[model samples]
Target: MINEIQHTAETKMQKSLDVLRDNLAKVRTGRAHTGLLDQVEVEYYGSMVSVSQVASITLLDARTIGVKPFESKMAAVIEKAIRNSNLGLNPAAMGDLIRVPMPMLTEERRKDLIKVVRGEVEDGRVVVRNVRRDANNDLKRLLKDKEISEDEARRGEEGIQKLTDKYIAEIDKMLATKEADLMAI
Candidate 1:
């Protein structure tokens, strides 16, 4: 029972870390990458689909992303989708290709982005802490039911704490790297 609780908590923590990573990726720096448009959705034949499904995304340069839809007619829709995705990007339709340029981050915008990243990191920490709390509670309940000894419960709690610390450290490292990326010219 103790092992199950610990394993479940660890899995939940790992998933939270993965979500945090995805969120951080969405917060773009000055550099451009195809992943930046991963969340963009476009209307396709009366249904909405991701930009990648209807078009191909590639990095034209360090600061520009090139998206070319399979059908030339879809280019306008893809450009509109990217513009409205609220990533603060401007995609111009140049014939069959849509060029999305990542604007340079100003000092103020960089500071704002850091604040946003810090908020995301804090949310990640909260999720990990919540998992730890729930696992500890499960251990206590097991102890109360006489299924686990007090010593065993204590050990399980320690193990859970170690997992929490490890995940939190990884989250912090991601934040530090993102901050450096944002600050770099």
Candidate 2:
């Protein structure tokens, strides 16, 4: 049972790290990436579908995103979706393709993005800590129920703390990378 609790905590902690990675990916770093539009959904035939479904998004250059709808008629729809996605992006309709240019980040904007990244990292830290707390609680419960000896409970708690430290370090590494990316000109 202690092993089970440890496994669950590790799984939850890994999930938190994955969330941090995905959130960081969506944060703009003055580069054009297809992941930037992964959250955008376009209206296609009365159904809300991802931009990738209705269009092929590619990076035309370091700062330009190229989106080509499968159907020429869907170009306007895809462009409109990008405009309304609240991502602060403007897509220009160029014949059958839509070009979304990633604007350069101002110094102030870069600072602001850094704060956002920091907040995400903090949240990731919280998630890992919470997992640790839950695992510790499970150990306590097992001890209370007399299902595990006091020594076993102590070892289990130590194991959980080790897992917490490992995951928190992972989050810190990811945050450092993201901060460097945001601060880079």
Best by lDDT: 1
Clashes of 1: 0
lDDT of 2 by residue, 1-185 (tens): 99999999999999999989998898999888999998999778888889888888899999999999899998888888889988889999989989999888899999999999999999999999999999999999999999999999999999999999998988889988988988888
Q: What's the CA error at residue 82 for candidate 2, in Å?
A: 1.4
Tens digits of per-residue lDDT, candidate 1, 42-132, equal 8888998899999999999999999999999999888888999989999999999999999888999999999999999999999999999
What's the count of clashing pairs in each model shown? 0, 0
User: Which regions in candidate 1 have their CA more than 4 angstroms from the true location?
Assistant: none
What overall lDDT, based on C-alpha atoms, would model 1 receive against the true structure?
A: 0.95
| TM-scores of the models, in the order given | 0.96, 0.95
Can you give the lDDT of residue 66 in candidate 2? 99
